[model samples]
Target: MKRILLRLINFGKKLPLVIKSIKKIYRYGGYTAINIASINYGEILKEKKVLITGGSTGIGLSIAKKSLQVGATVVITGRNDDKLKKAADEIKNPRLKTLKWDISQINQIEEGIKNTKLLLEGDIDILINNAGIVNSITFPNVTEEIWDKIYSINSKGLFFLTQTLCDQWMKEDKVQLKKIINISSQGGFVGATYPYRMTKWDISGLTQGLGIKLAPHGIIVNGVAPGIIATKMQPNYHAQEDNVFCSLNPLKRIAMPTEIAELVVFLMSDAANFIVGQTILCDGGYSIK
Candidate 1:
C-alpha cells in the first residue's frame, strides 16, 4: 500500500506538466513531431552572411553559436572587447569573427558598418538587433540622463543600424532574401516601467514600419518579444522571484536562451519566408496569461 501510494503521488506531481505539453501540441497541431532541441539545421545557412549585435553573451552568444553551427559566416559585435574575444574563442569557429562595436556611438557605428560591409563582401544576409540595456526607475526617480542613456543604445542606436543595413540591402540585387530581426521585450505589448518599456515599443513599431517599407524589396523584418528568459541580463531581483515568475506563464518556467536562439535561426532562414511585419511573442505564453 505504501509503494502504491508513492507511485500515485509521483504521478500526480508530474500530471500538470504532461497535460500542458499535450495542450501545446494540440494547439500547434502539425508542429508536434519536430523536437526543437535535437533538430539539426546544419549547413542550411552556409551561403548566408550574418551580423549579431551584442553577441558576446546570453541570447546573443547562443545565436552566434547556432548560426555558426549552421555554417553561416557570422560576425558578432559588442562594446566589451574582452567578452567578444572570449565568445569568439569559445565558439572556436573559423567562420566566426568578433567586432568591437558600441552601437550608441552613431558615428563609430557608421564606420563599423563600412568595415563590416567589406568584411561580409558587400552584402549581409541577416542582421540581428539584439543589443540593449535595462534601467529600472520609478517615475519620481526618472531623470533625463537615465532616459538618454537607455535610448542612445536601445532605441536610437538600434534604429540607425537597421537603417544602414536596410540601405545596403536595398542596393543589392533583388534575387536573394534579406532579413532583420529586432529583439523586443514582453513589456512592449502591455504597460510596465519607464524607458525600457518605451524602447521595446519602439522596436515593435520600427519592425512593422520597416517591414512594410522593406517587404516590396523581398526583405523581411520582424520582432521577437521574450518574457523572462533565463539570462543574467534580467533584473537581479528576479532571482528571488523564481516561483513567482514561473507562475506568470502557462509554461510554468522561464525560457532558455537556446529556445530564443532557435527561433532567431528559424526567422533568419528561408523557412520564415512568409512571416513579415509581426512581433511574435515567445514569452512562454506570458502575454496570454
Candidate 2:
C-alpha cells in the first residue's frame, strides 16, 4: 500500500511535464526522428582552419571530427602522442593534423602555436580551447597542489594561449575574422566551492572580456558550457553505451559530445560572426533545475 501510494504521488508530480510535452508535440506537428536524409551537409565551415586542444578524446574529439566533416582543416593537440595518433587514425582525414602539446606548460605555448601554424601552413581561423581538467574536491578538502593543477590548465593556460594567438594574428596583419571557443562546464553557473567549478567561472568571465577586447581586431571570443555530458570526465555516465538516462537532469538524459560539437561548429562558422563573447549554456535546462 505504501509503495503504491508513493508511485501515485510521483506520477501526479510528473503529470504537468507529460502534459507540456504532449502540447509541444501537438503544436509543432508532432516529433520525428532526425534522419540523415533530413540533415543538410552544406559545408558551412569550408575553407576554415581550426585548432582544438584536448582533441585526442571525448568532446574535443567529437568537435574535431565534425569540423573536418564540414570541410575545415583541423589540428588537434593533446598531451599524449599515442592518443593523438589514435585519434588521427580514427578520423582518417588528410585535412586532420595532430600536435602533442601540454597546455599547462606556459613555456611551451608560443612554440606549440608556432608549430601548429607551420603544420597548417596557414593561420588558424578558429581556436577551440577545449582542454580542461575536473575534480570533485570541495571546501575544506581542497589542497593547494590540486588548486594549482586545475588552474594551470583551465585558467592560466587558456589565457596565455589566447593572448599569444591574438598577438600573432595582429602582427601578421590578417583581415579575416578569427573565432575562439572555450569549453567551460555548466558547473560554472552555480554557486560551488570546488576547484573545477571555480575555474569554469573564470572561463566564463574570460570569454566575455576577450570577446569585447578582441572584437576590434576581427576576433570573436565565445564559449560553450555543457552540463552532465557523457564523456570520460563523467565516468559513470560514459560507461553506459545505451543508457542516456539521468534522473537529476530535467530532460531525463545527459547530453552527448556530438550535441555540443554541433553548437561549436555553428559558433565557428560565419553564421555566428555577430555573436560576441557570450558563453552559451548547453546544459539542457540543468542549470535552471
Candidate 3:
C-alpha cells in the first residue's frame, strides 16, 4: 500500500510539469504565428549598391571596404584618378568601381554622378558624403579664399551631390530604404580654431533638415561626427609626443578610420533604419569633455 501511495505522489508531482510544458508549447506557437505575420519580404543587405565620395583613402575607403565585405557593390569617387584606381585595386573586389571627379566643382559633381550611375547600373542604395577639408587657421587669420574653399567643398558640394542622388532615385522610382551618411566633425559641435567648422555646422543642419524631408520617401539621412581620428587630415596630431591630442578626450585615445567607418556602415544598414536625423558622435567621449 505504501509503494502504491508513493507512486501516486510521484505521478501527482509530474502532472504540474506536464501542464507547464503544454503551456510553453502554446506560447511558442503564438510567438511563431506573430513572427510569420511580421516577416519582411525583401533582401536585407545583399547586393545593394553603395556610393561614397572621397573614397580613395581614409574614412571613406574604410567604409567602402566594410560595405563590400557585406556583399555590397561599391562605387568610390575622388579627384585623383590614380588614387581612385589604386583604391579600387586594393579593395580587390569585383563589385568595386572607381570614378575620378573633383567634388568641389558643381559641374564636375553632375557629370560624375552620371558616370557613377552607369557604373552602379541603377540608383544608389546608400550615399556617403565623406569628403571634407580642414583649415587650421585661427579666426583672426582666416582668409576669404580659405573660407570659400571650405564652404565649396564641405557644404555646397555635399548638398548638391545629395540633391542629385535624390533626384535620380525619384526619377528611377527605386525607393527601397535609401540612406545618406554625412561625415561631419566634432568641431561643428563646439568652437574650433578653423573656419571649416562653419561648414561642418551646416552639414549637421542639413542632416537633420533632410532627414525630415526624406522620411516620406523611405530615405534616412544622418551624420557621424568624429573627433581626433588618426587620418591624413590631421598629420600634426600624429607627429606629437605622447599623442597629447588624444588625451583631450574623455576616452583618452584617438579613433581609427575603421572605427568611424563601422558607424557609417551601420547607419546605412537596415539595422539603423529608425536612427534618422541624428548626428552620432563617434568621438570616444571627446564631446563630453
Q: How does candidate 2 fare on TM-score? A: 0.86
TM-score of 1: 0.83
Compared with the true structure, what per-residue lDDT tens digits does model 3 show for residues 9-75?
9999999987776664453332111111122313445778888989998889988888877778888
Report lDDT per candidate: 0.83, 0.88, 0.80
* Candidate with better lDDT, 2 vs 3: 2
Task: For each candidate, give its TM-score against the true structure.
Answer: 0.83, 0.86, 0.80
Model 2 lDDT tens row, 102-193 = 99999999999989988888889999999998998899999999999999999999999999889988777777898999999888888979
Off by over 4 Å in 3: 1-44, 238-245
- For candidate 3, the C-alpha RMSD (Å) to the true structure equals 15.4
The worst-scoring run of ten residues by lDDT in candidate 3 lies at: 30-39
lDDT order, best first, reads 2, 1, 3
Residues 123-208, model 1: lDDT tens digits: 78889999999888957788999999999999999998888777877887768888999999888888756998889999999999
Q: Between which residue pairs do clashes occur in model 1?
A: none
Q: Residue 192's C-alpha lDDT in candidate 1?
A: 58
lDDT score, candidate 2, position 285: 89
